[model samples]
Target: MGEVAKIKKFLAEARYHHQEATSVDMVNVMKQYKGLVSNLEPYVFNDGTCRKLTNLSGTIPVRYKGNTYNIPVRLWLMDTHPYNSPICYVAPTADMCIKVSKFVDHNGKVYLPYLHEWDASKANLLGLVQVMITVFGEQPPVYTKSKAPYPTQQAMPTASPPYPVYPGAATPYPAMPSQAMPQPGGFPPYPSMASETPYPPAYPPASSGYPPPQQTPYPPMQPSPMASGYPPQAGVGAGGGTITEEHIRASLLSAVEDKLRRRLREQFSQGTAELETLRRTNLELVQGKSKLEGLVGRLDKDCAELDKAIATLEEKEAELEKGLGKLSSEEPIDIDEAVTTTAPLYRQLLNAFAEESAIEDVIYYLGEALRRGRIDLDAFLKQVRALSRKQFMLRALMNRCRQKAGLAG
Candidate 1:
């Protein structure tokens, strides 16, 4: 599956509180941040409840000392996302150490003004990550142990306490103006790397692949005398029996076999992990394919139903059109003489109902005129009362006539 498809699947399985909104936000973020990978991972909240949540884990670029470094970061989206902020952490590798500062705590949890003042209308994953990159550029969250001279125990900076620092607590890693400034004897620089010169550089370049490949050293081996074009010589043993060339040959062969076995085992382990990852990817693709097929089938069924409905509507339209043509061909009849009642009593009842309906329209217009100041309040009230009394009499007459004519009232 593609990245967007994978992200949709992950969010779907996790059962987010706001699925549609969260999916849109995450899809945009994933597109902008192609390096980041989305997955469903278990997240433990402060209340100790663990839930599987969508996680975006990857590295972001931060420039320091004119060089760019890919800073690893992990974001845990809350189930009620868009409304809630994501939990962000600076994930340091084994060789890297967390540099606690105003933005990052000892536990690698990130704190930022944007996150503190999160407005769902304006704030989003893309903006949150941008703020992190900018803040980290000024004060890096993590530094490689090989590049920075970060001692196990160092004096705290005296300037001001960083976040996670209690209200009245002492500042963590406080440094004096002289120390913060890279003087002759003061700290090397604000960051203070292990090296005085930036040769190998801290972390890998931003362009390097994620989770950079490990450089495994070749197994050490002591060369055998046979390589020198000289056969092993027999030597006198401490016990009195002479050491033979065959013994030396056998020892060298055993050493070579052991090294080969270890190398093969390492390769096998790495291959197995890669195979399992491929298997998971294949399963996800299969599921996506099944879902798409089902959707297509539903769409086809709906289309067929729509076609049947259209045909029914067309038939009804044709019948109405034919009837309209017949009426057009005939002469127009006076509405009053269109139908005559069988008895005079029924005729009187119909006329009374018509007069009563006319009175209702008159009263409605009077009210509208009153509302618009077209008539005075006294006149409006007087006219409404008179019309209402006439309407009531007409209705009574209709009821009496209906009874005499044996018609339903």
Candidate 2:
């Protein structure tokens, strides 16, 4: 089949541009599109970049009502390979004027976020195209000629081209035969009362309960007293009797009902208009909510990354503090021989402190007692206190010992 060769050619082109594509990825593309596509063609751009095109004209699952039906889908791939996402449309029969909607617009543009966010580095061409096909299966666009909000509601009459009149239909009174037609008068000559053209029924049938009373053989003529004295009134009905007050009352009631009916229709039309406006408003709100939720999800992900970084920093701080503690805890400061009266005992203390394992038994216990007794005072004050008290005591003891030794000599 031509279609099969086209797919093979497309695969070859895809492999050519994407040299890094793995064998497994190529196999996946071939297997996935075995018979799903019905047509394929290729074209080149002005810059000589090759583009692949394909269409699945067979039954693609399209949803309507509560059922999914097969429909044709046309697709066009970008000339720049995976770098450009494909553009798709749902093409119905010639007689079908597709409805404009969220899924498919008047121009047949399909709305799918995957195509909108296509990334050449990540998205596989075969998989992305498959996604596009599956999108229509879930909730297909509703195609209707009316395409009005709340379609089940009453349809408001809109201006439209006139349709051909059918035979036997009540038509407007025809103009008098050319010879009988009036030239100067704005109105057409009235028809013969003797003829049977019961006035053309109202343009729109009367909505009131009662029918309009038939013409009483006269135009705007009231009963004349001279004719009332006789058996027949001048403008009375064919019955040739005096007109009664009841006829007048009945005609007046019909007029009132017709006026009320027209007003009711106007109010109904206004309400439907308002409902359409509200429907659009609700749609806009839904779109804004979706965008806001997407932003919040991104923010939450960023916050999680920041929290991990902060935790890593805290762990590093703990390790650094432990190292500093070990260095300071193990060493003792050396004192000058002239300043210490403790003699060789002070020298022995400094040498024992230098060897990490020298302190034991009584020596370790005494060192521990001295360490526990020391207060963690302010650095400047603690240093002053250490030097003044201990150094003064050691110096005085050394002077006394020297004097004693000299006396013995």
Candidate 3:
């Protein structure tokens, strides 16, 4: 049978068993069936068939008084067997098992859990017994076919039969023509093979085919001065009808010379002004220097006069010093000695008059004798002493004679 037919048959069996089985019995049965199918070919069930079992009606699994259990439910399969399709199991509470309405994604394939709604009244008494027996029976071991089932191709009809045909026997039914197998609903259309059709040729490879148009080998161009028709040589001029190259060059030179001349004139004027200023400065310096020189000359003359005055004063001082020294060295003369040495006969006469004269006369004669230098100072002093002694003895004798003479009288 095809994969879809096999899935439909499994759903039918699950529905019949669900009506008779208790929730525990139903879970056990499902577990056994799951084990039995675990190794079956994956293509045996389509995703749509699984979804129908998950959303089955009426009987469902439920929790009563804190204990959980599965209740019998019914389902309709619309696609595989539209009429009188067997009812399948569902959970009383959608949360009891994974919702069949939800798909199971294993790798890229989708699997769905079983589901059912609950109904208390109707019972499948016989079906329940049969379901329990079926669940208890030893499960069939999982089997895998060694090779894939190949699709059979129908044989074509031949025009002639192998034996002669009876004339009136029911005409043998002509062998039916073989029809192409229907494609799987989910798979896409087959792609066309690439080898049959050719690709349009690529745009022809860029042409190097013709030798590039023969490049004319140009003659060596001669170098020309810009002054000539070509661009003016380094120091040349632009061409014009009336203006020759020489004229343009001359004009340029004249402009340059004019600029140089103006610069030179400016420099000369500056130099002249600087020179005039220096001349004035030089004149002032010369006048100042001359005045200084005259002051120096007058100072020299004053210095000379001072020197001469100092010399004359020194000469006069030296003469005065000599005279004072000579005066200090000279001795005073003795006037008496001088007179004695000069007088000759006056000495004896003065002495005789001094001895026989009266007192006044004697004083006069002594003075005369001193003036004549006749008296020796030493002899005169001795005479003066003898006279004093004589006068004293004469006084004593006169006193003695007076006493004696009176007695005698």
Report the lDDT tens digits of candidate 3 across residue range 1-409: 7433444455464443342233323334344322112111112243433432322223222222222222323333333322223244321232222211112111111211111222223332223323422321211101122132223445322234344433432242222222222122211132331211232111111111112221222111222232243432343333332223343345445545644654565356445645654665588789999999999999999999999999999999999999889978988668655545223334443333334344444456666776789998777667666665655554455445445445231
Q: Write the per-residue lDDT of candidate 2 for residues 299-392, one digit (tens) a residue.
A: 9999999999999999999999998899789776555543453466545444433332322333444445557865443543555555456555
Cα-based lDDT for every prediction: 0.68, 0.47, 0.36
- Tens digits of lDDT, candidate 1, 164-229: 332323322222222221222111233423322323235532111122121222222233343344
**What are the C-alpha RMSDs, in order, of all predicted structures?**
21.8, 22.3, 64.5
The Cα RMSD in angstroms, rounded to one decimal, for candidate 3 relative to the true structure is 64.5
Candidate number that wins on TM-score, 2 or 3: 2
Model 3 lDDT-worst window of ten: 200-209
Model 3 — TM-score against the truth?
A: 0.23
Please tell me which predicted candidate would have the highest lDDT against the true structure. 1
By TM-score, the better pick of 1 and 3 is: 1
How high is the lDDT of residue 49 in model 1? 93
Q: In lDDT terms, how accurate is model 3?
A: 0.36
